[model samples]
Target chain A: MIKADYNVFDTTHDTQYIYRKLLDCMARPGKIQSIQSVTRKLNDFPDGLSTLLAIALTLVDREVSYHLISDQSNRVHNYLKWKTFSEQASIENTDYLFINQNLGEDKIYQLMSLVKKGTLEDPHQSATIILHVDELSIDQNKRQAFHLSGPGINGVTTCYVKGLPIAWIKQRQIINSEYPIGVDFILTTTAGEIMAIPRTTVIERKEE
Target chain B: MGYVAVTGGRTAIENANKLVHSYRLKDAERAIEVKEIESQMRLLVDRVMGEGGLYAPEYAALALKQTEGDVHEAAFLLRAYRSTLPRNHYSMITDPGEMRGIRRISSSFKDIPGGQVLGPTYDYTHRLLNFDLRNESGAVEQFLEDFALELDTEMDTPSFPKVMDLLREQGLVANRKIDEVEPFDITREKLAFPAPRSARLQLLSRGETGAMTALAYSSMRGYGAVHPTIGELRVGYSEVHIPYPFADEEEDSIYIGELKLTEVETVNSFTQNNQGDVEFMLGYGLTFGQNEVKAIAMAILERSLETQGQSPTQDEEFVLLHIDSVEAQGFVSHLKLPHYITFQSMLDRIRQAQKESKVETGSKG
Candidate 1:
């Protein structure tokens, strides 16, 4: 029933705005950007899936593939296909991956490794992971800190993220060690905030 | 130079727009209707439609009228207008061979199955202008009278078959293996290097005529390694078909109305295939409306770029990036925008360099 109810609102204007926000998030690795969607009540959707869905509705199309890692429900997959017309791909071949919740360290590592790392000739062919988390905060005591330095960052900037296992970052580092051939991440929260970490970013865990 | 920057910016902008409007309506001899432009200035409308990548004749006419016959600006206006439209169902694959061909020619072989029909082209016309239309009244009436008489007899025309089918039958042309993979839509995603054939064709279809012509000409003038002959050039209407939505129904597809298209197939010299067998490859170009020159040139450039020879025109990035009417026009027009800050920075840097040189000279003395 929810699959049939999924809608794309303010199709052009909202998509353009969301697209710019997504671009800005990727351009500035540690900066948090907000996405405004017609579906304002993010709590109605299962686990922070609204933020991922909002971005996916704007960006995904039939040309690319979409994979849902944390979502076991066919409803979400069918809803994504119906709304965006994007192909439902397996984890290995997906252009965009929607992770509805934080996974265990082992599973995270396995998923990261399994995801497509683009070839050097076509670096943008790599997968983009949209990860939904419980909270995203900069408080060092409450969240794990990340030292980010990349093409987008003016210099090194430290940012903290919550609701994800600390070991996941280490696995991400291992997966993204090869330059120009790695997956990117769009860390999202139920509050409609997102921070992008492209493969170019040099990530270091401040406290293990 | 010392004058203070003027205020009332919004008022100034409004007045500047009024000035342009006044110039546009300077004489007010006659009001030009969109229908008049669509009918009378047809070639210009076709060019706009091709470059704009939209096949709406009325809108193309309106865009041409709005831009005062500036081809690039008219196309830009049409493209901007197209953004406001909603995405409907994508039309099914179009077969140009099934077109009701008004004009069909094959330069590869002169005495083929069907003789060439040079329909409504100025290819053999004299370059001198006919001055009789300068003060001619009832021009439209005379034209309609002349053409309407022939329409009755011309209605029973036959469909022309593709010349490439002969080559395919003889195994002379390279065999095309149909790939079931869905083609990438360039408008949806950013174009990557070593682009797919679909994206390449789409870009070339919407490319500006003059730019594509220049690149193709360069390739022909010994800059590249493709000597192309127009194997088949067609100007006709291709029917658009879309699949019917109901799953249980027996009737599978619906016929959307026909779209006028110009299709060109160019035959290049023999080349070794991947398996080291020699075969003559083909280049193809198709665009909206009767735009044969652009399609022909586009076919050559498509082949040239595919070969990836040691020339600027053969470079996919060079040809694809530069040929877009919108992008090229936008970039060239951006120079007219106020660049005081950037200019001031450049001037400061130059003056500083000059002062440093002067100081060095004084110290040396």
Candidate 2:
């Protein structure tokens, strides 16, 4: 029987591996690798995003509320609700919002506008976005010359991203200018490679 | 206006699982049976069962077999398995007075009422390996013939009194009551201090033998001071305690009767006077399986840990806290998981540090 196990006391070997990977992912802002045991099914997610599921499964606990812009079918929403026991929320009242290929500027802007601004009492209460981008590479979009000069970036780097929106980059830059108040991102390709593009990193897209 | 489509975390995870599976099983050519560990490597099985906090020796043997003799893995297996089974009934509290012992001896007196029945023991047996046992065609007889008797039949020896009990009756040793006071169960609840000797013994009994031994050794060397004597060492099946449904769990939780396990209980003697004439009973340690040395050492360490005025071993919290195999194993194996995120932050810090250092060097140079 496929049971939705939520408790830490009932941890499995693979679950522990997933848990550790999640910790590693969080500890470093924008670097991505595969977490253990999650599998992708076609059309289940709009962006075909499975890593979102992995992250949601790992961290979207009962205490948190999640909203989806791309998954209107509520397959992702219901699945997360059942599997991780996370509460469904509107864009207006959400701790986190998961967006993918289907979401446009209006939806993202609306969601971001509703996010609670960081307060002195709880800065972590602000909304975080787990944006799935298409194609992450160190040498992608040479004109943009995306230099990854953050904590995990070994040195200055340029990467090409095919599916990521230009406005989103501008939005990200605007948000990140506030430091400690910007939303973080995880960009994944169709091939399943990940490069964490956190709020802290600077990206200059080419061919404007 | 831009719409970026990105997300496929599931595929990465599936491959990681495959790698883990290959790392564990596919590489090994031959798989070993659990029975071999239970039968041949009995001592390891015993230690695993003792430390695992599970009384079932057979299951412990099976885990040891599966883990290829890794004690921590075996312990983790036991822990994982332990939480799965629902606690059916709380066993009655068995008294040491009602223990049916096969091997009982006292260091103070060579000849007691039971007359020292050293059942199956390695004590006095030469440590050298015997080559003749390699080609045994038939069933071999017991090394000591007289001790072996029919199962379920009582030995003709008189009912013997506990060495500590005798000492207490004489008014020559410190008196502590094992009466109505309930000893805390570590498994059911979180441990609180200052723990009673009974609570300490409960912890010591379930503790890993090696870790306990190291703590005891440390205490004996410099950590704690308690010149211990083996007042009595008994190995036999004792009655287990199961709480009756009708009885009070607070005041009288355990109802007594003969039980399921085979354990060795050791009683330690602590000297109270300089002349060493007047003495005190330190504590009792009982663990599942036949680990007499471990049992004896555990009792000694239990006493030394309680009173840490002058000895390093006296620090009970420090020693008892680190002696858990499960905790140590979990903390150590956790490192095998990824730390890319933390490393990224470290990279940033290193660049910052190097820049500052370079600036200082430039100023100096």
lDDT, residue B234, model 2: 73
Q: Give the Å error, residue A165, model 1.
A: 2.4
| Residue B131 shift from truth in candidate 1, angstroms | 6.4
Q: TM per model?
A: 0.70, 0.54
Ten residues in sequence with the least summed lDDT for candidate 2 chain B: B257-266
List runs of model 2 lying over 4 Å from the truth: A1-208, B1-36, B133-160, B196-198, B241-279
Between which residue pairs do clashes occur in model 1?
none
Instruction: Provide per-model DockQ scores.
Output: 0.09, 0.02
At residue B121, candidate 2 shows an lDDT of: 76
Docking class of 1: incorrect
Ten consecutive residues with minimal summed lDDT in candidate 1 chain B? B242-251
**Considering every candidate listed, which one attains the maximal lDDT?**
1
Error of 1 at B19 (Å): 3.9
